[model samples]
Target: MKSNFITKITLCGLLLNGIYSHAQQTTLEVNTSKTITKIQPTMYGIFFEDINFAADGGLYAEMVKNRSFEFAMPFMGWSQPNSNTHSLNANSGIATPVRTSQNSNNPDFCRILINDDKGYHIINEGFRGMGIKKDAKYNLSLKAANHNNAIKKIILQLIDKDKKVLGETVITPSSTDWKDYSSQIIATATEAKAQLKITFEGTGTIDLDMISLFPEETWNNRKNGLRKDIVQLLYDLKPGFLRFPGGCIVEGRTLENRYQWKKTVGAVENRETMINRWNLEFKNRQVPDYFQSFGLGFFEYFQLSEDVGAEPLPILSCGMACQYNSGELVPINELDPYVQDALDLIEFANGAETTEWGKLRANMGHPKPFNLKYIGVGNEQWGPEYIERYKVFAAAIKSKYPNMIIVSGSGPSPDGAFFDYGMQELKKLNADIVDEHYYKNPEWFKENATRYDNYDRKGPKIFAGEYAAHPKGVEDGLKENNWLSALSESAFMTGLERNADVVHLTSYAPLMAHVDAFQWAPDMIWFDNLNSFGTANYYVQKLFSNNKGTDVLAITKDGKPLTGQNELYATAAKDVVKKELILKLVNTSGKAQDVTINLSENNVNAKGKLIILTNQNLEEYNTIAEPTKIIPTERDYKMSGKKSVLNLPAYSFTILKLKMK
Candidate 1:
């Protein structure tokens, strides 16, 4: 009898344990009637920097690398190839670089002396070779002065790798004075690695400057505009704001090398070219040929923002160079010019046509104001020097434009000695918005979902600027934009949305990269000479930005936020204009979870839409060959009265949209 009783007790215990485990279901209670805060239109945006060849060789449609012969090495992109003989002395001609005193901004030009015209040709190796299409027209323009009219004609040809001409155009030099000549070449065959070959037809001397080539097709078909395909990806994001100029490029290695907005405006030819700060930034990935042509200047950035319907957020230098490099500082007394630049920029952006800077804007083809609102003082600056410079800028800007919103920096990290110090000082000054940046492992992102839960509600708002998850175990020099990084980023973004009032704006860093000439890894978008694609992280950002509702709604489990409870994170919002409720849930676990979301009010339609982004392998990522390896899939979902049962997939970010009854 005793043995029988023991067996019954053990069996009963097992039965009860199974029942209890099965009954513990994850329940989320959402308060639909109670609105937490209004989500800012600038909540989800994009941050653009010139790192990784993002500007000259990537976005700016100009194919000629050193069009004006202004690089430190004048013939950096040009090569003189001898067709008849292998000996250098047997070549048909020699080109000499000359710096003229007439033009200070663009003084360098190529003076070619053709000896016998035995196929004297110079080939320009374009930005990793120009991307050409069949039957497409390319506009070729150059400034030439035929010395003694010795060079009768300039023959231009687009040639493939085997030296076969794909397109041809001829221009006759009729004048001895500097004059503009233009012609169009139609490519007969498509080629990805084509070079521009210029052959002289006479045996005399000629000078050439501003030898530029652009695709007839561009963003909006403007003369010398941005690449159409790249711009389309940005336009599709529908970002709230577009930050311009740079990450570290704004703060050069030295103060003199810093990006000066004044030089980047005005005519394309007159704009001065400067050495890109990223030319030698990384020892492992040194791009010696990198240089800034300023073809995609401040005006083009503002124009792009307008075209994409995003608010223009321009970050300027704060009289200090990049601390990681030279750490050069302009003394307090010498800071007047920097302050004046800020004042003048506001005038250039918002002032009428009669103002000094405003007149220049009108002359650049934009008569109306850009309607600029937000301006950042610096990019990842720190310490007492930064605070000192920021104070002067804030006082001066407010004195002139009181309503303009000024974004202040909180150093180079999300949390550290410099970040803490900068945050404390900026808070004392009552800053408007404080920018914070972070690049950490995926686990760090998943753990920091509640970072701003205890933030001071009354202090300055937060701009979660420049963030990316660097997955662990990746080699030191290489980082992958894989599914794990994207999933973890989604988990952190839930917290960003939950505290909508405190976190006003956020954007991912290092927006673009080139396949063959990149200096950084894990960029949001990757492109080459011909094709471009968004990464998995980019799709996550798009999901949030597209489904970001107007007002925040409280979502909780057991009377608290569902942050990392059972590896789940969630946030809810309601769109007043669309009359829809959006619930975003992220599951970072390896097992599927059954969740029941209970609505406080019975005001949601039974039918809803669900979008899920998931991948079975965390290391799976998108490449140029497999662009859509991990993308979101949408489907219709059914609800039961005031409650909905959602089977959240493992390692997935899901968005549910329900219409208000």
Candidate 2:
């Protein structure tokens, strides 16, 4: 009798557990008849900044260090290592960089004086170290003013850690004045950390500036171009828009150092070098060698946008320096030149070939216009001074080009007195688009999925210009780029797509970072000398951008929007081009979720496709060693009649594509 009673109790417990599991199941209703808004093509995009050695050492493939000799501490990256560390004699050949007062912009050049024949060598440690591949060709170039033709030949060699030569080239300085010299070096072996060593043949002094080395095969095979592998990754995303030239660097430490677009165009050599705003951003990641080479300047930005089939959106400084640093504002009288810059840029982008700036653009090999449509006034500025300056810029731009859309900023944070003031003022001024930035925690992102649902529908459209969920505080210790943060962003991205009319454009900030040399943590993409890989955040971005639909459909549960109810969130869209209905679902729970989606007012095929991205651990991330660790996996999904039931795994992002009959 006791054994029978125990068996009955176990049966009862199993029955009760089954009942509770059934109760947890939910139903989602997607009404295709109720089209909320038309989705814009510029919905998902990329925000680019020069932070974290993103340009010179990260994107630009120039392997030479101190290319222009323009760093604050000239010859900071170039070093002369003694043959022996404990040598008694202090004397060896020396290379001394001299600065003249002839040019305020570029004033430094290294003067080499050879004393001992002990093979005096000056070695350049590349941004970290140059990634050299065997059987590849490298171009070595420099400007040399051989003093009285003192030096006979300069031998340039690529060496590895043990000082083994991988490649070699010889350059004979034939110019008495400053002139350019170019030679090719063919590598004999592969090395991830290679250094450029210059060996002098005779004892003499030679002035060298703009020392540069680039791969013979660059992006689009253009001379002095960007890294091919990095550009390829960007092109694969099919991004809608490309925001160029900065985050805080657009607003320099002071007005004198602010990024000037005019200085970044025309001849690459003539383009003036400027101090990067991120030079000392993080005291821990201090990089005194960081500076803008301007080789990948405005023209290159537009060219990259064109190459990726994305709209080019440029942000310019609006007469004010970085408020965080100096808060220096140009006086109203001196603001004319600032306003004139805006006008000239529009002409340079869209004007006819007969115009002055347009002629310059034509001379650079692009006769046709760049077809620029949007321009941002400032980056994360606020207060009464910003409003006053924005008013002047808006009026000037409107007077000349009324159809051009101008983007204005709403301070740094998402909420505050300054943000509120900027939004209210921009709305009153009839601003076209209002740029907002956020760098918060992952929970903040999941909770704010409906951030744009209550925005003023009739006001200026939103440009979520810069945003990323920091796993910990951005200033906190060892902030990592993990799956939890990227998954939360995927949840928030569905909301951005649902409210596409108001949220016209969005992108992740600080696009690329070098692993060894970086200031900011939690970047979207990371790279080293020869290899680059996207983070979990990058794949999330790729899924949304590549699968962005033409129109948004209403997807609700229990007659209300699904924003984290039962730890599940969802959004629906219809792709008229592909003749399919798309449903994006997120499950942020520990247990699997059983969901039955009912599609009304649309005849669907019995078979569909599902792409799911999830991992067993939330803290797991994609690194250079394993980039595809958290990528999406696709499978064929079949529907029963007009309804489809799915068992969503815990902490997963799933996308359903149902064909329409």
The worst-scoring run of ten residues by lDDT in candidate 2 lies at: 1-10
Best by TM-score: 1
lDDT of 1 by residue, 225-321 (tens): 8999888888877799999897789989999999889889888888999999999998988989999999999889999999988999999999999
lDDT for 5 in candidate 1 is 7
TM-score of 2: 0.93
TM-scores, one per candidate: 0.95, 0.93
Residue pairs clashing, model 1 = none
The RMSD of every model to the true structure, in order and in angstroms, is 8.6, 7.5
Model 2 clash pairs?
none
Candidate 2 per-residue lDDT over residues 122-176, each given as its tens digit: 8999999999999999998999998888888899999999999999999999878
